[model samples]
Target chain A: MKTPVYFDYAATAPVDPRVVEAMLGLLGPDGDFGNPSAVHAYGRKAAALVEEAREEIAALLGVAASGIVFTSGATESDNLAIKGAARAAARRGRHVITEKTAHKAVLDACRALEREGFEVSYLVPDRGGRISAAQLEASLRPDTILVSLLHANNETGVLQDIPALAAAVRRHGALFHLDAAQSAGKVELPLEQVDLLALSAHKFCGPKGAGLLYVRPGVRLEPLLHGGGHERGRRAGTLATHQIRGMALAFRLAVESMAEESSRLAGFSSRLIEGLCALPGVLLNGHREARLPNIVNVSVEGVDGEALQLALRDIACSSGAACNSASGEPSYVLRALGRDDALAGASLRFSMGRWTRVEEVDYLLERFGSELTRLRRIAGAA
Target chain B: MDELHDPARYSPRVLELFDRPARLGPPPGANREGQAENRARGSWLRMYLQVEAERVVAAGFHARGCPHTIAAAELACEALTGSDASELAEYRAEFLEAALPLPPEKLDVRLLIEDAVRAAAHGRR
Candidate 1:
């Protein structure tokens, strides 16, 4: 058995070999390394590649090619979607709505708006990390012009009922922004009513420095960056042809294989959950049936979270969101779901991906059980 | 030493002690035990001492904490094993802290260890 195994796919996935192959074509001197903004022949060639890739990504999402605005990645896309839309509609309203379990990108973007005097409502989710449509509808007011929420919770893989939530926002005439960073290319998205959606390329095995935000036609959003009017004046940096092509190709590949891949990963997820929950005092974190099949998060009662994290160094799993790991704080997402700090901090999130095998899952389970027992004994809990 | 060392986060010495804390669990015929908790970090340390003739003959511990806290307790047990029982009254984690260099964030674990030693001393009297 490999000493160190990887199970933290939700943090970031290994770049697909196909994406790497396609990206190489546009990077070297012999490649199409032309400035996409240039009016010259090389520029035209690069621009054509970018547009084709855009069309492919857009087709995968079932949206118009013109709606996609390529950005650095999901962080930028989310910032652009939330702040850009909020600032553009400031005259219409100063209120925005989001959930407690949103990604920091969405939450922080809302925070920035709050500093600018925008009133932001952070709706707490149900104990299962779910934000109901009625909860959202009750919070929406005449002045609430934007509602930003993620389609799936990154920490626990708990999926929100986006269609129902989006309908509530629509009824209030507020623009809905979906942070589909975890769901896109992995699940079939019902996004016909979503006005703005954020996508991270790396989440779907694409390049890291690439992502896009879909801006529905007729929705006004102020540009985040200012320069030569790239991305139709929505995002202004010079286009990265290679990254864009890689992202597009990666999305296409994921969507093409999603059906079989989802089923395979769901099976792995089920087996892992069963093995883990069978242990005494181990509690599953998310809604059992309403979560993404790739991520399995559970809390081990009476186990030292930090010690458990240290012992499981052989398995590349997370105690919480990778972004917040350095802070040494209990996951705010779990706390929002009413888990005490002890249980919240003790939680482990194991996410599987395309390359994960059943053997690897079994190895993780075996290692987890032994480690739990050892740590419990050390703590005098066993 | 296992592959658990994140050099930026933990010292090799800390990992060594955490992995194989030989002094862990109650020493044979321990008559007094004291526990301390750092609720903020959700960590705790319990220290047990076997005292005879007003001298600590054996010491052991059980802990639930980060590597640094557990390692500090392990080192604490070693330091307590041969000391006069009264020394626990004014025991400080300064020696343990010096032996195992820690980052600024984990400095509180020292206080927890000190509190456990004091608690053990209080229980003995």
Candidate 2:
């Protein structure tokens, strides 16, 4: 049987073959498999590979290699960036600002801080799932130590104006953190404007288990992990040299081909949006113009999102609700934008990526239209 | 591709019922109908039954929910048809739960199916 067409790139992308090949050179007996912390020659070689990987990632983000600190993945990067910074700046202030639509990594970190007597203000986004610069400025207070937000939403592909928002945060005398896990390799990032940024390798065709947090010079953070002074005392752990190498290679490839890939994806997204919107009772989620090119989220009226997802078993996609859980909560991001539970629950996120083709998009459109019509008919929608 | 997918996430029986529901949609000229929903969880079910001499002669269901809930609804309709209406009041979610071997978190699906059937029986009385 033919496998299902993958359309959940927002969740995670397959590692690029080039990245895999690079990783293979660092993994086995003949490879640079020694611990990076060892003082031996093999260890030195491994450490060199790690530093080279860091440079590749730094080059893509337009930041100095020294600013990057590797972690297990974005979740750890987010926790380290937010919690570490918030705790370090606690003496100066106890307040923080973030949008409600941010990934759970940021929100949960903020929530953890809240338990420690810190005040967090979750800014509500507009109907298009966007937080304006004015909104950020208004939310910032004298005690606001940091403002963390996503560069691009994982579910809706909504892109925030990071430069404008960063400027607003800085003007308020607060540090700005961008969870660029979703947008790192997909688009250009204004790294100079952000004080701290988090990224994941798996999101951009790198192997999983490795990510980075870029800390701007002069910024102080309370280390989340303490021991052995790894990551310049910011984080402590034996780095996975192979994973880091793969990430660097993946980031390099993504940056090298970003312009052309983005253009191609934009065309595919446009075709998908056009086709989906032509269906009766279909509504697109998020700002049409301010979203990433690879993801198109839509809500089909009168259809259950779970049923639709099941109907489209041949197309791997995600619903706006957390389908993995029993509660099945509609995406908080959509809810923050004022979408009702039913509409949010009915939304589907079709994310395309490097391997996506025009023919697959057409097939998906047809499948979606037919399944939606069938489901609506069964539901007796007018 | 197999590595990319997880088959164990869904039981084969649930997949079978979801792929080919035995009693989907409303039975023609159903004498009794009932609807139940767990709006917070986005699960909804509408059940129709034809009763003759206090016995369910035919049954069908239409549901919009996850695979477990849909499968449960279909399975309920299959189990209830040709049974005495009084059996509905005694119907327990455990029977369906065991048959489907539903996860603990998905016990709500069994309850939803039971609610639809009981509602249908109540309407007939």
Candidate 2, B1-125: lDDT as tens digits: 33343454457778777767767666776888888898667778888898878788888877777778877877888778788887776666678777876877778888788787778767752
Tens digit per residue, CA lDDT, model 1, A49-76: 9999999888888999999999999899
Cα miss at A163, model 2 (Å)? 2.2
Candidate 1 has what TM-score? 0.97
Give the clashing residue pairs of candidate 2, or none: none
Cα RMSD of predicted structure 2: 2.7
Which pairs of residues collide in candidate 1? none
Residue-level lDDT of model 2, residues A1-382, one tens digit each, is 2448888999999999988888998899999999999999999999998998888788778889889999989999999999999999999999999889899999999999999999999999898888999988888888999999999998889999887888898898899999998887789987999999999999999998999999998889899898789999999989899999988888888889999999999999999999999998899999999999899999877767777777787888888756743445777778788888878878889998899988899999988888886666555453
Highest lDDT against the true fold, candidate: 1
Instruction: Assess each prediction's global lDDT (C-alpha) against the native.
Output: 0.88, 0.85
Worst 10 residues of 2 chain B by lDDT: B1-10
